[model samples]
Target: MPGKRRMAQSARAARCLGVRSRPGALALVACLMGVPEARAFDLFGLFGREEAPPAPRPDALPYAVRLQGVEDDDLLSALQDASTLYRLRGEPPPDGEGLLRRAEADATRLVDALWGYGYYSGTVAFRIEDVVLGGDAAARAAVRAAEATRNRRLVAVRISVEQGPLYRLRRIAVRDASGRPLDLPARLTRVGDDEPARSATVLAREARIIDQLRAQGHPFAKVVRREPVVDHADRAMDVAFTVDPGPKAALGAVAVRGTSSLDPAVVRSFIYAEPGDPYSPEAIAGIRRSVTRVEALGGVRVREGEALDPDGRLPVFVDITERAPNLLGVSARYSTVDGPGVRGYWANRNLFGGGESLRIDADLSYLGLGQDYYARRRKLAGIETNGLGGRLAATFVKPALFGTRNDLLAGAFIGREVQQSYLSDAAGGTVALRHRFSDTFSVQAGIEGQVGYARDVLGRVDYRLIGLPVSVSYDSTDNPLDPTRGIRLTASATPYPSFLGSDPGLFVAKAQGSTYYALDEDANTILAARLGFGSISGAGLAEIPASLRFFAGGGGSIRGYAYRTVGPIGPFQLPIGGRSLLEGSVEARIKITDTIGIVPFLDAGTAFASSLPDFDEPIRYAAGLGLRYYTGFGPIRVDLAVPLNPDKALKQPPVALYISIGQAF
Candidate 1:
C-alpha cells in the first residue's frame, strides 16, 4: 500500500505540468523518478548531511527527457542547461495541469537552446503515453482531457529532442562610409568558414577591428554598424561590420594647456610624440609612467585635436596640474645581520621651474643595539672593524639640459664601511651626464674625486682616488626588483689617474650581466643566471686603495664565505684585494604560491692575483637554498649556504646565513 501511494503521488505531479516552464521542479522530479535510471536515490542525504525531500504519492505523474540523434556532448549539455524541465533541482511539485503548461513552453525554449550551439533548426516533441502532444491537434486534445481528471491518477510524459545541424560562418566583410572597402586591410578578425558562428565571438572580433584601425594612425575611427544574417537552409551565417576610419594623420604642433606657473617649453621637452611622427597609442599610454617618475605632477590628461589641419596633421594637447614643490619622506627597515636602518630625504621637484630637482638624502645604519653577530664573534686578527657602518649623500638633478634629452646629475657623499680585513672613511664629489636611448636603455659618464683614510692588514693610511667612470646598460625586465624575464647587462670602464697621496694610476674594466627566463607565461617558475668579471690594469691590487681593488664573497657572491674572503690570502690569514675577479651563479626559482617561493642555487668563481683570471689557483664554490616572500616592491630573500672547499687552516662556519631584498643574482 505504501509503495503504490508513493507512485501515485509522483505520477500526479508529472501530469499537472504545463506550458509555462517550471524547469527546476520538473528536472528534479525527472532525475529522481522519470529519467531512464535504475533505482538511484539520495537516502536521507546522509553523505551531504542533509535530508531528502518527500517522495511523490502513488497517484502523482512522472516525466522523462529522451534524446534522439544528438551525439554532440557540447550541444547535449547546452540543451540540458537551457531546458526548463532539465534545469529543475529539488523544487516544489506542480498543480494538476502544470505538466501540460510546461510542455507547451519547452517548444520555444528548445529552439533557443539549439541556436546557442549554432543550430538554428531543431525539433522538440512531447507526448503523454501514446498520445502525441506535438502539433497533432487531436492527440493534444486527448492528452489535455486525461490530465484534467479529477480523480488522482498516474501519468508519464516524454520530451523527445532532435538537435539539428550546426551552423557555421559562410562569409564576412567590413566596409567604410562610402560603401567601398577602405585602403586599410580588414585583417584583425578571422571569421573562418568552419568555426561555430557564436554571436559573442563575432562581436568581439568586430571590436578588435575598430581598435586596430584607430591605433594605426586613424584617430577618429568608428564602427557604425554590425550585421549578422543567418541562413537556416544551408546551416551558415554571414556577418559584417561597417566602419568609418577617418583620414590618416601625423603629429602636429604641441600645446601645453592648463599650466599657469611652470615653463610651457618644459612640457614639450617631455613629450616623445614629436611633430611629423605618426600618431601613437603607446605614447599616449606612457604618459602616466613619465609623469609619475618626476614626482612633479599631481594629475594630467592628454587631449588631441578633433580634426586634422590643412597640413594633414593632428595637433597634440596636454593639460597639466602641479603637485607640492617640496616633499619630505622617511623609511626604516630591520634585518638580523644588517641591523635596523633609517633613511630620510627632502626634495624640491620644481626648484628652478624647468623640471629641475634637488634632493638631500641621509641614511643611518646600525640603529638600536643590534650588531653583526657573526662578524663580531669571529673577527680575523688584522681586521679591527667588526660591524657594518653607515653612509650619507645628497644629489641635484637638472632635466632638459640645453634642450637635449639628457639629465645633468651632481652629487656628494660621505661614508664609513667595515670589510673583512679593512675599514674606510671616505668623502667624494661626482658630476655625471645620464642620457636615455629609450625607455629600457641608458648610458652614464661621470668624473668622481674622493679622499679616504683606511686601515687594513697593510695598516691605516690616507689615500686619494680619482677616476673617469663611464657605464652603459640595457635593462628590459618587467619588474625592477623581482624580474621573471628579460636580461640586464652593464659594462663599465673607469680610468683612475692617481694624484695626491696616491700610487700609480689604474684603469679598471668591469662587466656584469644577469638573465632570467620564465618556464611559463604565468612566470611562477624562473631560471636565473648571472656572470661578472673585473680587471685592474696599469697597477697591481696592492698599488690602489684596498677599498677600490677587486674582491668577492659576501651575500651577493659566494655566500658561504665572509665578505672579501674569496680572493688570494695575505697578511693575518685574511683575503687581500686582487687584480682580477670573476663570479657566476645559477638559480632555479620556484614559486610555491603568489606570495611565497623557493630557490636552489649554485655559485662558483674567485678573485685572482694576476691581471687576467688564472685557473691554476682553486676556484671557490658554494651551493645553497633560499626562501622568498614577495612584497609590493619585490621579493625578500633569506638564504642558507655551505662552502665546498673552506679554508682548512682556520675554524670555519659550515653554513652561512643571509637576508636581503630581491634575488641573489
Candidate 2:
C-alpha cells in the first residue's frame, strides 16, 4: 500500500512539472524532491546528455621493478636484457590479465639467457604486489585486487634469480661425418676441457673448424652435426661436432661479369690467381681488393661456383659495378693568418679504357681583407704586397704497371706562392714508381726537376734543380680524414747534387708520424698525437732556395702564430727560413652528441738555424679548443687558438682562428 502511494505522488509531481509522459520525468522529479536513490540515477544520461569521457591512459605506464640474487654483473645484465618485463617496463600491459601473461613469458626467456652463459640450472621467480605469480588462484586473486585499487599508481614488480654453479665442458670431440675421429689440429677447435660451457664458444668453435678446412683447399667443407649433452649431477657438459670436408681442389677458369664501359682485359689483369694453382681464400680477397681500388668501379664481388668444374677444380667469378667516368668537386678553407682559400678539381677515373686516372687541380688563396695584415703589422721590410696566390696542377696514375704491384705516377705543377717570408713562381714535374707491399704499406722512388725564380730578404734569383726523391709510408688507421685508431708513419729524403743545380744544392730529409687511441668502446672519446722532424743539409742557409728551406709556423705546423713566423728572423724582422724543423701536437676529441664534438689541443716546437733541431733553442707553445660538425664525408673543423708563450718582439696575435676540413693531424 505504501509503494503504491509513493508512485502516485511521483506521477502527480511529474504532471505538475508538465512532463508526465516523459520517460525520465519521474526520475527528475524524484531528484528535485531529494530522494537518495533517485539522485543516484542520471536524468541527463536518460535524456541523451553526453557524459564526460574517461581520461586517456598514458603511453607508458608507471611501474617499479627490482632484480635480485645475481652477483655477476655480466650475468645480471644478460638476464635483464632477456626479460621483457624488465626491458619494456615503461610500456606496461593494458590490464592485470595482460601483465600476468608477460610475467609468465619472461620466466622462460630468462632461463634461456642463463643457459647461454653456462648456468644450466638457473631459475627465475616473479612477484607482483607481494603475491608470487604462477601460484594458487587465491594469490592471483590478491594481485588482481591490489591492481584494481592502484588507480594508475606505481605497481611493484620483483624478479628473484637463483643461478647455480657454472657448468664446465668435460669433453670435446671432432669427427668425420662417418663418426670416425679426424686428424685436425687441436688449435683449430678453440674449446677445451674444464672451460665454461658457453653456447657461443661452442658455436664459434664449429665455425673455426669449418674455416680451417676451407682454407686448406677444401671448398665444400661443412659441419654436418653439433651435439651437446649436459649432466646436472656433475655440473658439466660434453660437446661433439661432425664435419664433412669434400675433395680438395685447385683454382680453375676465371671469368668477369657486369663490366659495362670497362675493359675485360683490365679486370683480368688484377687477378693474382692463376688456373691450376691451389685454391686460396686470400687470393680471392686480393683480387677483389685490386678491382675495388680502381676508382671507376663502385662495387666488386668475388664468388666461387657452387659446384666444381669437370676438372675437379673450383671456378671463380669477378662481378663489378662501374662508377661515373668523370668527377668534379670543390673545397674551401679559411684562417685568420692565412686568409681564405678555395680549391677545385676534375678527374677522369677510366681514361683510355684502362684503370688509369687523370686529375687536374686549381687553387686560390689570400682572398680576404686581412691577407697581409700580419706582415704589415710586423713591419717586414722586403715583404711583397699580398695578392692572390694560386696553383694549377695535373696528375696521372697507371695502376698495375708491367703486371706487377708497382704503379706509375706522374704529375706537373706550376704555382705562385706569396708568403710572409718570401714569394716564388715555379714549375715542376715528377715521375715515380710506387710499389704497394700491402694495403697498409708502400714505397716510392721518383725523379723530379724544377725551374723557378724566388725573391726573399736576400734578393731575387733564378735557379734550376734536379733531384731523386725516395719515400716509405705505412698507414694502419681506419679513416684517412678522421682516424680513431692505429698509426700513420712516413719518412722521405730528397737529395739534389751540386752538379745538377745552378745554385748550390741541398739535401732535405723529413719524418712524421701520428697515432690515435680510442678511450671508449663507441669511440666517443679519442686521444691523438703527432710528431714531425725535418732537416736541410749539404748547403748553407743562404745558398739554398728559400722554398727548399724549412719553416714551422702555420695552420699545418704550430698553430696560434702567423705563417712562417716561428723560425729564425733576419734583418727587418722578416722570417729567413731555417735548416731544420721540429713540431708536435696532441688533442683529446670528445663527442657531446652524435654529430657534434669538441677537441682541446696543444701544439709546440719551432724551426732552428742549424741542420738539426737545437734543444737549447726555446720552442713555441700554443693551446686551443675546437668545434666539429660531423658529416658523411668528414668533420668540418673550427678552431680558436692562443699562443701560450708569446714573443713580444714578433708581435704575435692574441688568438688565431682556422676553419677547415679534417682533423688537425
Candidate 3:
C-alpha cells in the first residue's frame, strides 16, 4: 500500500513537470524520494489549491512617436534612434512602471547622443497622453491613467529636443604622463581648431598620438588620461590628452607556444623579426601572417611582454593552434561547351612535421556529352570523340626553406586531354623556388620537363621537352575568393631549349591583371575588370605542340565560344590554336540579397596567327549575365552567354551555358 501511494504521488508530480510516460515518472519520483530536501517540495500544491484559469497575456499597445523642435534632419533622426520608447513602442511594457523606466533611460541616451553630435547643451523632454513627464510620481500616474483608459485608440508619445549652438574646438593640447606639454607636429594631431567638437574626433586624435609614439620605438605607449573642458558662454570645447610613452625598446628573443605535433623550429622560421631590431607593430603583424600561411595552423596570436627585458628589448611570444593535418575534398563543374568534369583531392598539410604540404588530385572530364555533335560539325578524323579524359597530379610545398622567406615547390602530373582540336597524352614534372618579398609580392623560377604524344590536324607526333619558367605576381586584394577591392597582376615567361626537345623549341610570354572596386562601403556592389596578353615565338604554328599553343574561347576565356574553337581554322574547319592571344573583360557584381547576386559582363578577345596580337585582326566579342549563390567559402556561379558576332563560316552556337564556382576571373 505504501509503494502504491508513492507511485500515485509520483504520477501527480510528473504531470506537474509535464512528463508523459509512467516509467519516466517513476524514475524521477524514486530519485526525489531518496533525497532529504525533496520532502520540502509541495507535492499537493497543484491539487490542494483552488486555482483559477490563468489570464491571457495582453497584446502590445498601439502607439505613435512624434518628434518636435529639432529642425536639423540629422539630429532629429539621431534623437529618434536613441529613444528606446520610440524603438520599442509596439512591444508594450508589463505595466505603467515599466513604461516610466524606459522613458527615463531614453532621456539619458538622447542627451549622450546630442553630446556626440557637438550639442553639449541639448535638452530632451518626453510626454505621454498629453501629460509631460516631469517627476517620478507624476510620470508614473500619467502612464497608469493611460493604461486604464477604455478606448483602444492609439496612444500618443511625444519627444521634444532643444539643440543649443554647436560647440567648436577652441584648442587641443598633448602632454606627457607628468603633465608636461609635448610639442607634436600639427599634421600628426590632425583635429584642427574651429572644427566641430565631436567626441569621436577627440578620441581618434588621442589614439593617433599613441600610435605615432609606438611607431617611433615606444612599444609601451598608451593614453594615460583624456580631458575635455566645455565653456558654455563661448560655445567652445578644449581637449587635452596625456600619453605615456614607456621605454624605447627593441625586439627581444622570440618564443613559440601551443605546439603539439608541430615542430617549434619550423614555426620559428616563419618569424622575420630578429633580436635587437626596433620593436614594430608592423613587424608583429607580419609575423602573424607568416605563421597563418601554414595550412596546419588553425589560429595564431602574437603577444608582447608587459615589461621590457633586461637587454632593453620587448619579448615576443607567438601562440599557435594546430588543425587536423589531413583533408579530403571533391569538386564538380559543367558547361554546355566543355561538358562535365569532377575532381577529387587528398592533402596532408603537416606532412613530416616541417610545415610541408602535399596534395594529390585526380580529375575526369568529357563524358561524351556534345562530343559527337561537335565532331560531326567539325568533320574531324582520328580524334577520340565521346571518350573519357582524366589527369592525376601531385604537388608538394616546403615553407620557409633555408631559413628565408622562400618556399620550395614541386609537382608532377600525367593526363590525357581530349578537346575539339587536339587529343594528347602527357606526363610532366616541375621543381621551383618561390620567394616572397612581402605580403603582396612574390617571384618564382622553375625548371620543367615533359614527354607527350599528340594527334591533331597536323598529324601524330612524339615530343620530349624541357623549359625554364619564371613568373612574378602582386596581389593586394582583401579576399582571394570574393575580392571587393584592390588589384592583382601576374606575368610569366617560359623558354623551351631547342636542344632538349625533338623539334625547335619556342619562347612564350604572358601577362594578365584584374582590378576590383566596390561601389558601396559594405561591398554589396562591385566593378571588376581584367586584361590579358600572351605570345609565343621562335617556332612556326605547324611545328609547335598542339597542347602548348595559345587557344582562347571557353568558359574560362571568351565564355560564348566552345573550348579550343576560337583561333585560326585548320583542315576540316577545326581551330589549329594560335601564336598570340589578347582578352579583356568587365563585369558589375550586384548583390540582391545576402546569399544571391547578379552580374552583367562583357568579354572581348581573340587569338592571333602572328607572334604578337595584330591590331588589324577583328576581336571577338561576347556578352552574358551570371547568377551567384554566395556561400561561406565562395560563390557558386551560373552563366549564360552569347556571342555578339558569330562567324557564319565557323557555324558557332548562338549561346553557351557554364556552371562552376568562383567568379569568371
Candidate 4:
C-alpha cells in the first residue's frame, strides 16, 4: 500500500516539476529530519543559488589579524590566506568584519595564482571599512580599504631558467610562397639548440631573418615557435620556429607611362620583370637602374609608384614623367688604349614629333706608345694619333612596333680619324647598323675605311694606306645599367688594303666576350679574356701593310705590362713596346654594403713579336688588388698593379697605377 502511495506521490511530483523551488525550503526539511549541524548542507540553499549577500553594517566591530592560525610560520601563512575572512564570518559577526573577511578570501585566491610560478611568498591583508561615502560609494570605500591592506608583498620572486638558451635562426629557410628554396647562403641557420638561450636576442634574430627573406623574394615566409622544451637528460634546451612559407608571388606586370619619343614597351624591355616571375624588392629597385641607362637617350624621368593589383595578378605601374628634351653635354676622358678622349654631344629627341631623334657628337683621341728592348739593337718607339672624330646620327623609335612585340631603331654615323704610327699616318671613316632581336638579345654591325700618310722613324714621307674594318656585337641583359645577370659579346676585325707607299699591306683582327653569373643573393664574379694577332709582310697583292702591325700594351693589356708589349717579332734591339699580346683578369666582387663593394683580382698578360731580340721575349706579368666605387653611371675603378717580372732597364719600381670607368676589360 505504501509503495502505491509513494508512486502516486512521485507522479504528482513529476507533474509539479515546473514549479519553482522555494529558497531555504531545504533547510526546513533538514530541521524536520534533525540532521547534525556540522555535517548538514541545506539542499534548498544550494539549489536556490542565493543572491549576493547584503552589504555588512558600517559601524560593526572591525575584523582583527589575530584570526591568523598556527604559530608555525609556513602553516600560519597558508592558513592566514585560506581562512583570512572565514574567522570573522562566525555567528554574531563583527560589524563590517564579515565584509573585510570575504575581501581577504578573494585576495588570497588571486595571490595564490600569482605565486604558482615561483613567487613563493606573498601577503594578503585588508583594512577595516571607513564610514565615509554611502551606497555604492560606501562599498567601494570599504573595498579600497581592504585592498590597500591586502596588497601583495612579493617577498622574493625565486626564478630559475625555465627552459632557455634558445638558439634562434641566423636566417630563415628562405622559401617562396610556393615553398621553394631560394638561393640562400649554405651556412644560414634559423633554429638553435644552445643552452641558456637568450630569448630576446633569438626572437629579434628571427624577425631580422624573416625580413631578409622577404626582401630576397620570399614574401610570405613566417616563423612559429612551440613552448620551449628543456631537456634535462642532455642539459640543454631546444627552441624552434616552424616555417610557414607562403607562395612566392612574383611581379606580374611592370607598366610605365609618361613618354612621347620613347616607347613604353622599349622601356619595359630594359627593366627586370616579367609575368609569373618571383617578386623581389631588388627587382623593383631595378626600375631606377633601367631609367639611368638610357636617361641620356630620351628626356625621361621615372619613379616607383603604387602596386596596382596585390592579388598576385595584374601589373604594377611605375610612374614616369618625360621632360621635353632641350639639353647639351660635354666630357673628356683619357685611357691608355682609348687615348686622350674628348666627347661633346647635343640631342633633340622630340624634334618634329613622332619620337624622332636628332643627335650630333664629336669625339677626338690620340693613341701613342714608345718602348725600348734590352736584347735587340733596334730601338723603336712611335706616336699613333687619331683626330677629327665626329658623328651625325638620327633615329625614329616607336614604343609599339609592328603592333605586336618588338622595338626598332635605324641610325647612321660618319666619322674621320687621323692615326699616326712610328712609321705611318692613317685616316678613316665608319658607318653602322643596330637592331634589337628581343629583350634578351641584340645585334650591331658596322663598316669602316681609312687612308692616311706616314713618315717612318727616319722621317721619310710615304703615300697613304687604306683600311677596311668591320664588326658585329650582341648583348642580352634585363638591366643594362646594373646587369646582375647576362652576357655580352663583340667581334671586330680590320684589314689594310693598301700598304704605306710601296710597303706591304697589314692585317689586324680582334674579338671580345664578357659574362656575369650571380652566385647568391649578394655576390657575383666576372671572368674576361682577350686574344689578338696581326702581322706586316713586304709583298705585292698579299703584302702586309707596314703601318698596320699589331701590338698590345697600356691600360687594357696585362696590368703590370707596358703598352703594346706582347708579341713575337724577335731579335730586334729592345723596342720600347712588345708586339704580341695576351691578357686576362679574374675579378671577385663582394658586396659589403648596399652600395659598397671590394674586388680582389689577379691579372696576367704577355707580349711578344716574331724575330724579336734575345731579351725581347713577351713581357710576362701578374698583379693584384683593386677597389670599386659604384655610381649612377657605373662602377668607378682604382687599381694598383705590381709587376711580377721587373725589367732590367727600369730605374723605378714597376708598379702601375690606373683609374678608369667600368670594368678593365
Candidate 5:
C-alpha cells in the first residue's frame, strides 16, 4: 500500500511538471542518461516535430547512463576509450534494456581498463533502475504503473568507479640469452606509470627493441620473454624482457627454387648479400624489391634459412614465382588536339630466359573525329588525312648487364606524324644504358640516330640526325596517379655531333621538375607545381627543323593555346618552333570525396627564337579549373582554360576545353 501511494504521487508529479507529455526529452531528463540534471541542455532535439518512438510494451527502463567518481581525466578518458557501451552513447533509437545490458559489460571490463592507468584496486558499482525511483522495489512498482498507461519507460544506468591509486614507475629489464643483464637503451628498459598502460602499445615497442638488436648484426636475435608484474598494495608495476642475441652471422650460400624459364643467375645477380657480407634483413628487402621489379617476376620471398651453417654463416632462401614470359597490353586516351588515340604492345618479359626483356608497340593517334581543329587560318575538316598519325617501336632490355639495378636498352622505331603545321616521316635507333642508384634515383646515357623527311612551313626537307643524350632523374612522390608528397625531377642533355645532322651541331639540354605537398591531414588536398626549361646552343631557329625544336602550347603544355602554336610563326602564320623554351604550372588539387576532386590551375610558358631563353618573347599565361573523377585505373581529367592575353592570331576561342587522363604535367 505504501508503494502504491508513492507511485500515485510520482504520476501526479510527472503530470504537474508536464514531463509525461513531451515523450523523448522528458523521458531522457527523467532518466539522468541524457541532459544531466546539473548540466546545460541543447534545445535542438527538443524543438523538432518528429515524434519520439513509442516505448516498448514490455516493462523496460528508459535509456540513460551516468558515471560517478571518475575524476582523473586520463583515467576517465582511457576508461571510456576502452569501453563498448560508452561508444554507443549517441546511437539512435535509444533502448533502455540495451543500455542496461551494455552497462553490465562495461562493469565486467572495469579491471582490465583500469590496469593501464595503474589502478590496481579499481572497483565498479553498476546499477539500473526506473528513472523516478530511489530503490529497486520502488523502481519495479513504477514500471508496473507505466506499463498500465503505455507511456515512456525510461531507465537510468550508473557506473560508479573507485580508482584505488595511481601506480608508479618500475624497472624494465633486458637480459641476454645467458640470463645476464645487457645494456640496452635506458628508455627501453624503464618506463613511468603516469599514463595508462595499453598492452598493444607496450608490446609493439618490445618488437622494435629486438629489431634494433638484429640491425646491429645480431641476425638471430629473438625476444624470449615478456613479463609484466603488477603490485596492487604498493600500487606499482614492473616489466622485463629476455632477448637472445645469437651469433654474428654472414650470408653463407643461396638455395634457389621456382626457376624454369629464367636462369638462376638472373635472380642471384640481384641479391645484394655476398657470401661473407653481414646478414641484414634490410639489404635482403632491397634485393627483393629489385628482383620483383622485373615484369615477369611475382611473389618473391627472401629469408635466412633454418640455422646458421658450421662456418658461422646463414644460408639464404630465394623463392620467386615467374609470370608468363609474354604479355599483351593496350591503352587509350583522348584530348582536343589529337581527338582520341589507342596503343597496344606485346612484351616478352623473359626473352632469353635470362631476364632479358623485349617489347613491340604501335599506336595510332589524331583520329580527328571529335573536336574541330583551329590550326593556323584553316578550320580543318574532321578526320582529314593530314590529321592521322601512327608509330611502331621495338625495345630490348638486358637487366643486370653491368650490375644490379642496371640495364642495357636497344630500341628502333619508325613513325609518321601529322602535327600542327607539319607532316613528318621518321625512323630511329637508340642504344642506352640505365642504372638505378636507388628506388628514387636513376641515370641514363644513350646515343640515338634518325633519318627523317618533313614538310614544314619552310618546305620539304630531308635530314639525318644523331646525338648523345644523358639524363639523371629523381622521384620521391608517394603515388604516380595522385601525388601528395615529395618531388620529381628529370634533367637531360643532348649534344648533336658535327657529322650527325645539318643543324650546325647544336647541343640541347632541358630539365623538368615538379613538387607535391599535401595541405590536409587526410592528404586529399594538395598543392603542386612544375618548372621546365629547354635550350639549344650552336644552332639558329632556321637551322633546326621544326620537329626537333620546342613549342610550348598544347594539352600537355599551355592549355589555352593551340597545339604547337606558342612559338615563332612564319609568313604563312604556321608555327616554326623555337630554340629555347620555359614553362611553369601550378595547381590546387582539392578532393571533395574519395572519388571526386577539383583543381584550379595556372600555366605560363614561352618559346624563344634565341638559343637561350631570355624572356624576350611574349609569355603566354592561362588560368583554368578542372574536374577530376578519380578511379582505380587513373584520374579522368576535364579542364577549361582561357588565355590571359587574347589574340586573334590564336585562331581559336577565348576558352579551350580538354579531356584526357592523368595530371596535366
Candidate 6:
C-alpha cells in the first residue's frame, strides 16, 4: 500500500509540474551494477524509468545527494532515480542546484568521451521528473526517494560502431606532363591499420600510394579504390585499379644549327651522341661542353626536340654564336744557318659574316758564320770560311673556306742560302693545302723548288740545283707535355729530277720516324726515340751544303758536344750529321708533387755514312739528370749530362748543360 501510494503521488506530481523524461537520458541517470549511488546521481542511467525517479538519502547522512524543494515522496523517488546525482550511503545533503550542475557537466563529459572515440557528432543529455513526499518524515522520505533514483540500474546500453573498414591498393596508372601514359609497378600499398577492407575509406590512402609511385618515375600514376558493392554485405571489398603504359622513347638523332664560325666537322667529332642513342641528360650536356672547346666562339644553347620529319624521332640541337677577331701577329726564329730571320702576318677570322678565317703571312731569315785562320808568312790573321745563308717565305691561308674543318693555305716565296765550304747559295718557295681529317688528324701536301749559287773553300764554283720537298705526318697525342701517350710518325723524301733552270722537281731523299711513350700513371714519364736517314748528291763535296746534312753529339742529340760541332766524315771529325743518325733516349720521370719532378736519363746516338767514317763505330753515350717545374703553359727544364768517356773532353770531361722547354723528341 505504501508503494502504491508513492506511485500515485509521483503521478500527481508529474502532472502538476508538467515534467517529461527521455528514456536515453533516464537510462544514463540510472545506476548500473558496480556503480555507487552517490556518484550515480550524475548519470541519467541511475533513474529506473521515465515515470519513477529515485529519492535522495537522509539530509543528515554523510555524502548524501539531495534534489532540493521536493515535497512528494513518489515524485522525489522518480526524479532521483533518473538523475546523475548520487551520494554515499551516509552523507550530508548535496543541494539540488549542485546536483543539476553536476549532471550537466557529466553530460558534456560523456559527449567529449564519445568524440575522443571517433564519435564526432555524439551527444548526451539529462532527463528530469517532479516528485512529492509520501509518508511520515516526508522530506527524509523524498530524499531517500532521490537516492533510489540515483541507484537505478541500466540494462543493454546501445554502442554504435564509429570506425569503418580498411582499403588496399590493387594497381596504379601514370602519365607525364605531355599527357603520355607511363608504366607503373603492379604492387600497391594496403591502408588503414592493416585490417580487412570493409569500406571505401581506403581510397584516400590509395591516392597517397599512387602519389608516391608518380614521384618515382611514374609521373602520371593514379589510384582509384573501386568498391563494387554499396552496402558491403559480404564484409569483403575487392578493389580494381587500371594502369596504362605508353611507349618508351629513345634518342633518334642529333642536329646542330647556328654554327657560323666553327666547322661542322669539328663539332660532330666532339659530340657524344649518335643516331639511335638512348636519351641522356649527361650526353646533352656534353654537346654544350663540345661548344666550349672551340677556340674562337661565343654562347652555346642546347635543347632536345622532335625531328622535322613525321618519323617522331627525338634529336638533340646545338646552336652557337661565333665571335670575331680582326688583327694578326707574327714571329721569327734564327740559327747559324738561318740568320736574322723575320716574319709578319695579317689575319681576319669571321670575315664578312661568311665565317672565313683569312690569314696572310710571310717569313725571312739570314744565316752566316765563319772561323778565322792566320798565315804566319803574311804576318796577318785572315778570316776563313764557315757558312752564310738567307731564306724568305710567304703564305696566304683561308681556313674554313667552305665553313668546314679543312683549310687551303697557298702562297709563294723566294729564298737564298750561302755556304763557303759548300760554296752554294739557294732559294725556294712552296704552295700547299692542309685538310684536317678529324679534330685530331690533319694532312698537308705541297710542292717547292730552289736554285743555288756557290763559292767553295777550295775555290770550286758550282751552279745552284733545285729540288722538291714532300712530307707527311700523323699526330694524335692530346697532351703536348707527354707526347709519348700518343705518337707522331713522319716520312719525307726528295730525289733530284731537274736542273738549275727548270727548278728541280726532286732530290735529297730523307726518311724519319719519331715515337713517344707515356710511362707513369699520370703520364709524367716519357721515352722518346727517333731514326733518320737522308742523302744529298748534286755537286762536288765542297760545293754541296753539308750544314743542311745530319750531325750528332749535341745538347739535344748525344748531349756531350757543342751544337753543330760534331762531324765531317773523318777520323779527326766527331760523328758528323751523317747520312744516317740513330738516336734513342730512355728516361725515368716522376712528378714528386704537383709542381716539380726529377728525371734521370740515358742518351745514346750515332751518326754515320756508308762512304766513310766506319758506320759500325761505337755509339757515344751520356747519362744525365734533369729537373722540371711545371708552368702555366709548359714545363721549364734544366739538364746536366756527363759523357761516359772522360778523356774525350777538352776541359771538364765533356759535361754539357742545357735549358729548354718541351720534350727533346
Provide the RMSD of all predictions against the true structure, rounded to 1 decimal. Answer: 11.2, 18.0, 14.7, 20.2, 12.1, 28.0
Model 4 lDDT per residue over 395-427, tens place: 344332433333344444444433332434454
For model 1, how does the per-residue alpha-carbon lDDT over 1-665 read when each residue is reduced to its tens digit? 25554345324322322111223222223333344222112223222322343344435444444545677775665455545544442342254356566666666665555554566556778765566785557455745654553234434456777766777877777888678865555456455668776543455566677678878988888777656666655777676667888788888887877765566666655665667888766656554345444556777787788888889998777778988889999999865445677889999988888778888988776622244433432345445553557788888988768767688989999998665566788999989998866556789999988888876666666667778899998987767788899899999998877553334577889999999999987998999999999998886566666787788887988888766678787765666778989999999999999999999999988999898899998898999999999999889999999898976753456888888888786
- Candidate 3 lDDT, 52-106, residue by residue in tens: 3223244534455677888776566555555667556646666556766777877
What lDDT score belongs to each candidate, Candidate 1 first?
0.69, 0.76, 0.77, 0.45, 0.70, 0.47
- Candidate 5: 10-residue stretch with minimal lDDT: 16-25
Q: Ranking under TM-score, best-scoring first? A: 3, 2, 1, 5, 4, 6
TM-score of each: 0.68, 0.68, 0.75, 0.50, 0.67, 0.48
Considering every candidate listed, which one attains the maximal TM-score? Answer: 3
lDDT of 5 by residue, 1-665 (tens): 25554345334222222322223222223322333333212334321232343344444433445667988765665455434444454442233435544655565455455544456567777655534434566445544443443334434456678987766545567888688987677666656556333343345556778777877767878777655655444555566667888887877887778888887776766665568887777766766665676666867888777789999888888898998888899998876665788999999999987789899999998846346344433333221245778999999989877346677989999998877666778999999999877667889999988888776666666767789999999997766777889899999998888876544577889999999989888988999999999998886666666678888887788988877789777655667778899999999999999999999999999888888887757788999999999998788999999888744565756888988888776
Q: Give Cα distance to truth, residue 462, candidate 3, Å.
A: 1.7
- Indicate the residue-level lDDT of 622 in model 2: 96
The candidate, 1 or 3, that scores higher on lDDT is: 3
**What is the per-residue lDDT of model 6 for residues 160-223, given as tens digits with 9 covering 90 to 100?**
2222222222222344445555354444433344343312223433455555553442333443
TM-score-superior candidate, 3 or 4: 3
lDDT for 65 (candidate 2): 69
Error of 3 at 516 (Å): 5.2
Cα displacement (Å) at residue 30, model 6: 66
Q: How many clashes in each structure? A: 40, 0, 0, 75, 7, 84
